[model samples]
Target: MSRVFDAMMEGLRGNLLRMGGRAEAILDKALRALWERDARLAQEVADDDVEIDRLEVAIDEGVLKALALQAPVAEDLREVLAVKMIATDLERVGDLARNIAKSAARSAANPPIPFPAALTSLARSSQRVLRRSLDAFSRTDAELARAVLAEDDAIDRAQDEVVESMLRALERQPTAASQEVDMIMVAKHLERVGDHATNIAEDVILVAEARNIKHAAKLARNR
Candidate 1:
């Protein structure tokens, strides 16, 4: 029974990793579509979210099976809980990416706004966070998880800059305020992606070290 439980845990890990990979791909494609102003590509990312939803369901099932069959304890319990939490976080990340893609597709219909460097930086920083968070999960590297937490400040600053720039644009061109609002919304969604990535990284830290590091991350940032 112990061997069976171990094998089931391995399968659970594989499913969670696969879900993470899919969510990461969704974010990458969404960013590319936004940067390139490719409506078709953006729509494709939105459409692909159906698959992400399916994967979420599958991940939940895996978690259930692990709990029912393995009755995990101690480290095993932490691992299973982490998988469940991370799966939910990845689902939210996928949803945020899809929202960004939809905004990108909408922007394609309007006259292209000069893509601000701040917005571009925000997207790049968020993509890096998502990638690093997944890598930390895969390796159970607490240091890598902490690094992801450390980078959140840059993402937050970029988000602030992007939103402020859009607000200024709105004030300058009231007639085109609607388009600026859409751009701001996209920036907000990307910021949320960064947030979800941070949450996943925190979950990895908890699973690996059995310490709640999220509060520590916040305290360290303030210091």
Candidate 2:
């Protein structure tokens, strides 16, 4: 029975990792479409959401099964619950990426707006957070997970700068409002991606250490 439970846990981790990998890919492709103004790539990302949706369903079922059959306790219980919650977050993250891709496809022919430097930085920073959080979960490294939380501040700052720059650009040239709106939407998506990754990292911390550091994270970063 113990062996069966252990195998189930392993399977759970494998499936969750697969979902995470696909979610990360979705964000990457979405950003690519936005920056390069490639309608084809944006369409491709929008279509890929079907796969992510399927994975979310599978993960949900697996979590329910683990809870019913194994009756996980302590860290094991945390892992099971975390898988369920993280799967939901990853699914939403995928949707946010797809939303950006859809917007990119719509604006592909509008003559590329002057690209904002802060937008690029936000995307890169969010991407790093997602990658590092996944790595921390794979290694069960709480310290690495905590560092990812710290990096969220950088993402927030970048988003703020992007908003300010966009506002200024709009004020200077009201004709550019249409383009500025899309740019702000893209930056907002990237910021939300960072937020979802932060949620996942929080789950990892709770699962591995039984520590609820989420509230602390908000206060610490605000300070």
* Local distance difference test values of all predictions, in order: 0.87, 0.87
Candidate 2's C-alpha lDDT?
0.87
In model 1, pairs of residues that clash are none
Question: Which lDDT tens digits does candidate 2 get at residues 117-199?
Answer: 99888989999999888888888888888898889888988988899999999999888787888888888888888888888
Candidate with maximal TM-score: 2
Candidate 1: TM-score?
0.93
Candidate 2: list runs displaced more than 4 Å.
217-223
Error of 2 at 176 (Å): 2.3
| Candidate 1: segments with Cα more than 4 A from true spot | 216-223
Clashes of 2: 0
Candidate 2 TM-score, C-alpha based = 0.94
- Residue 12 lDDT, candidate 1, scale 0-100: 75
